[model samples]
Target: MEKIATREAYGRALAALGEEQPALVVLDADLSKSTKTAIFQRKFPERFFNCGVAEQNMMGVAAGLAASGKIPFCSTFAVFATGRAFDQIRQSIAYPRLNVKIAASHAGITVGEDGASHQALEDLALMRALPGMTVLVPADAVETEKAVRAALEVDGPVYLRLGRAPVPVLHGPDFIFRLGEAVCLREGKDATIIATGIMVSQALEAAQMLADEGLDVRVLDMHTIKPLDVAAVVRAALETGAIVTAEEHSIIGGLGSAVAEALGEECPVPMKRVGIKDVFGESGRPEELLEKYGLTPYHLAEAVKEVLARKQAACR
Candidate 1:
């Protein structure tokens, strides 16, 4: 299987979109090469703006460009993009509901070797809290490209959370992506594993491992977190009887919270959330961090059984 980082895919997709959409523009906070926005900058030099490390100024510029009917995609590290310039995003772009796309790279604990200061474990929470902000976390390169195109078509603010590490391709070119919809990767009745971002692949692996042990677990790729697929979440709860939510982000306000909120209101069930447990990340290899943070396939498989046990005990 081929492997590519979501950030690389974002850059390629933005460059492709630039060819189709004349008003499309790219902005980087002096890290275009790392963020992969250099791909677009090289192609559309006139439309690209290097904001020189000022995320606040870059966001304001993006908002201004959006107001002028130009679709601006602001790129930077997720931590800086969400935390450093949050006020600007809320006031300039989100408050006004401008057509600005914030494509943040190196999100989550996968920003290995960069430590907690660089890793953005809480970006989703911050972005989802904003009014009318659309949040997307793609699983792989294919989905990242599809999401980039979808975000470009939307009218208001869109936050795309991208990873720095390369991941295996999970979908083919024919895979269609729709905003606020969850994709069921595998179907089963014992339990359901709902995951987002890089954890989607791990969830799939966990499902396969459980299958070997005669446990049938459903898998769902919940790419969009804000306007969550409530119907799918409800269906998973109603049909599977148990749920395990996973993500590369913190469990506090990410995919787990969104799923729990939906299930709590609509269809209550036994649930287990697999994610960073309200702690900071450390400098290490991406794979090592995943294991240490309990975001691995083994952990997911165990969570599936743990929730299933609870569900069974409840039924008895």
Candidate 2:
């Protein structure tokens, strides 16, 4: 399969949506080309706004546009989109439930050589904490396109986190996407691995490898971080006897925390989480960081094996 970068998918999706929806507007902080909003700027020059290196001001501008009934999508590196302008997003978008979409690029360790300063590893936690905010992290290029189209229909504030690295297409054109809904890619009873963002693909790869060792692993794409698919998570916990939650964000407040919150109240199970540890990242390539932080398919496979072993021991 030909791998395409998630940023490219955002560009094509923005261009398609810009041509179709006149009310849609895009803004960037002098990084339109890097964030992949240049495509939308090219096709819909009047609707696109380049705020020029001012992330905070760009966020404020988006809020103003949203107040005026225009659906604004603010694009920038995820760090600046949420870190620098979090207060604006909180007061302007979430407080009023404004119809604005923050399409953040270069999320997670996928920013590669740009180092930890540009990577947005904490975006999921930040966006999920905002009241009335909808957080969506697409797994790959194909899913990124679907996520962009879906963000428009959501009634309130939505944060669409995207990445820069080229990844394999996990779904075909027929995949249906919806906000707050999780997709079950593979079904199993031995153990269920719930993952979001780029880790979804890694979970799937781990499941395939584990199946060869006689462990039937279930894989779920838990894309919506906020308002997570609790029912699906609970059902998996009840059926699988164990779970492993994974993501590209910090383990404390991302998919792991959400799943633990649901399962702890409902059906508790022997479980573990795979994600970035509670520490700041350093400069490295995406693949190197993933391996260093134990975000690889090998690590996921090993985690599943360990969790299954623990569950069996408890049963005995």
lDDT of 2: 0.89
lDDT digits (tens) for residues 58-170 of candidate 2: 87888899889898999999999999999888887789888999999888887878887887888888898889998998888888899899899888899998888888898
Worst 10 residues of 1 by lDDT: 107-116
lDDT, each prediction:
0.95, 0.89
Candidate 2 residue pairs in clash (backbone atoms < 3 Å): none
Q: In candidate 1, what are the lDDT values of residues 179-207, reduced to their tens digit? A: 99999999999999999989999999999
TM-score, per-candidate, Cα-based? 0.99, 0.98
Please count the clashing residue pairs in each candidate, in the order shown. 0, 0
Top candidate (lDDT): 1
**Residue 13 displacement in candidate 1 (angstroms):** 0.3
